[model samples]
Target: MTIYEPTQEALRGELLQRLAKLSAPSSAKGSVPHGVDSGVNVFGYCVNARERFARSRLPHPAVVVVLSGTKEVWRGDVAQRFPRGVPFAIPAGLEIDLVNIPDPQSGRYESICITVDAPLRQSLRASLNGLPDGPSIPGSFGIALSADLVEAYGHAASALAAPEAATAEAVARHRIVEILLLLSGTHVGRMFVAVDRAEQLEAIVYADPSYAWRVEEVAGMLGMGASTLRRHLKQAGTSFRQVCLSARMATAGSLLSAPGYSVTQAAQAAGYASRSHFARQVRAAHGVAPGRLRSVA
Candidate 1:
C-alpha cells in the first residue's frame, strides 16, 4: 500500500493538534505526559521550555517519535541528534543524557513514546519467524520513519483513543503489532532482544535510587551471591558501584527535569545529603553544572 508522506512540519502540526485534543491543558513552563491511563497505547510527552537532563534511564524497550523540535541523546562517547519526525529505538535500562530543545517559534519539544514491554516483545518473538535469540547490539539508535510506519502509528493512536473500552485494547494491540511488525524489519530491531546483567542491576537501582544499596544486598535481591554478581559485572565491564552511581544520577536527572523541583529536592531524591556534593557529582559525570542543567534562555 502506498502511503502519502506529508512534509515534516505538516506532520508535526497534525500530531500536535491531535495531542492537544487528547491531553489536558498544561502550565506555562513544565511538561505534559499522557499515558495508558489516558486510554492510549501511545504516550505523548511535551516540554514547554528547553530542558537538559543527565543519566535518564529508560525502563522499557521503546521507540520515541520526535514530533517537533529536537532531541539530543548522549550515550557514552556517542551522541545522536534526533530532529522532528524521526523515530529512535531505545533498549530497556539504558542510561542517556538528554537535551530537549524546543522549536524557536513554537517553544515546545514534543514526542510520542511507544513501549514494547516484555509481554509485547515476547508476543512479537512468538508470532514472527526467524527471530534472533542472541544478545542485542548495545545502545539506542535512530531509524528511518517510513511513510507506512507513520500511517501505522496514526492507526495505533486512533485505536487507543477509541471510546469502546472492550474493543479498544484488542484493536490497540493489533495496531501496535502492525507497527512493530514494520519496525522488526529495520536495523533497530536488534534492540528488541533480552536485557543484559548490567541492565538488570541498573533497573533495580533506578527503581529506588535513594536507597542505601550494598553489593551483597542487591546481589541477594537478584538471587545471586555477591561474588557471582561481581563476576557477572566484571564480564559486563562494569562494577556495582558504577551502576549504582549511574542509576542515582539518572534518577536525579529525572527529578530535575520536571518544573518546581529544586536542586535540593533532586539531590535528596537521588540519595545525596549535601546539595553541593550533588552538584559536583553531576558536573563530574555529565560535564554540566547543576545550576546550568536547564537553561531557559
Candidate 2:
C-alpha cells in the first residue's frame, strides 16, 4: 500500500479527533481527545453528564472513562458503576446501555469514552506485537474496565481537547499503545465478555449449533472436570445451564426477526431439540410469544 506523508500514528490521532467530533455526548463539555492516526481508526470522543444521562447502542468496541461525573454501564448481563476516575469497556458485537446517576451534591456530572472500532483490531495487534502484555487491560479489553484505568483514561481523554496542532495525535497513540499491551497478554479473550457461562461455553459446546451437545461436551469445552467448571461459574455469577438456555434464546430471537425464519425454523436453528422447548425459552425472555416479534416492517 502507498503510504501517506504523515506517519500512520499522525493519521490515527487525526481520525480519533474526527470521531470525537462525530459523537455527541449528552453533555456539552464531553471529553475532547487528540491523537495520531497510527494507521488505525480510533473513535476517541467525549460526552458530558446530564441530570440523568442515558445512551442507546452503537456498534463498536468502546472504552469509556468518567472525567467529572459518575455513571453506570450495563451490558446484557453485567452492570458496572464507576466515578470520575476510572475506565470501562463496551465490548464488540454486544448491545450497550448507559445511565449516569448524578452526584446530587455536585449538581452536574460528565463522562468521556473512546470506541476502538472492531476493524481497528488489526492496527492494535500490529503496533505492539512484540511488547510484553500489561498485567491489565485498562478498559476491560471490550469486556469491562477497571477503576484506575478509568482515572488514567480520564487523564488521557483531556488530550482530545487539546488543539489539533498540539498533543492530539501523540496522546491518542499513547493510549492505544497502553491498550495494545493489555490485549496482547490475554491468551484467549477470556476477560472480554461478562456474558453468561453457557454463552461463554458455546465456543466449546459446538459453535455449529446443528451439532449435538451433551452436558459433558459443554463442560469439556471449559477444560475443567464437569463438576469443577460448574462450581467455578457458580462463584463467578454465571452457570452453563443458564448460559446454554440464554444463548439459545438470544439466538432464537435474532433468527425469528429475520425475513424468512418461521418460529419452527428459528427453533431448530438455535439448537432446540424441539419447537416446544424453544418457544418456552423465548416466552420466558421476551414475555410475548415469538410470533409477536414478527417484523412490522
Scored by TM-score, the top model is 1
Q: Flag regions of model 2 displaced more than 4 Å.
A: 1-55, 76-78, 127-168, 183-297
Per-model TM-score on C-alpha atoms: 0.56, 0.41
Most lDDT-accurate candidate: 1
Clashes of each: 0, 29
**What overall lDDT, based on C-alpha atoms, would model 1 receive against the true structure?**
0.66
Residue-level lDDT for 158 in candidate 2: 57
Per-residue lDDT of candidate 1, residues 1-297 (tens digit): 997767766655554454344443444334344435222245667787888888776656678877668999875455889887667776655566888998888777777777766656666666665453221211236665556776777777776666467776677777777888887776456445335566567655654566677888766655679999899999999999998888777656655655677788778778899888899998887678776774421
- What's the lDDT for residue 107 in model 1? 78
lDDT of 2 by residue, 1-297 (tens): 985465434443443343343334555444444343643344433333353334344444455544445666664345667665444454443334677655567545544455554335545545544223221212222223333333344345555555464666677667655654453344223223223443346333222343444566555444457887688778878876676665556556656766777888777767776767777778898676788865531
**Residue 272, model 1: Cα distance from true site in angstroms:** 40
- After superposition, candidate 1 runs with Cα above 4 Å error: 1-41, 130-140, 164-166, 195-297
Worst window of 10 by summed lDDT in candidate 2: 133-142
Worst 10 residues of 1 by lDDT: 131-140
lDDT of 2: 0.50
Q: What is the C-alpha RMSD of each candidate to the true structure, in Å?
A: 14.2, 18.8
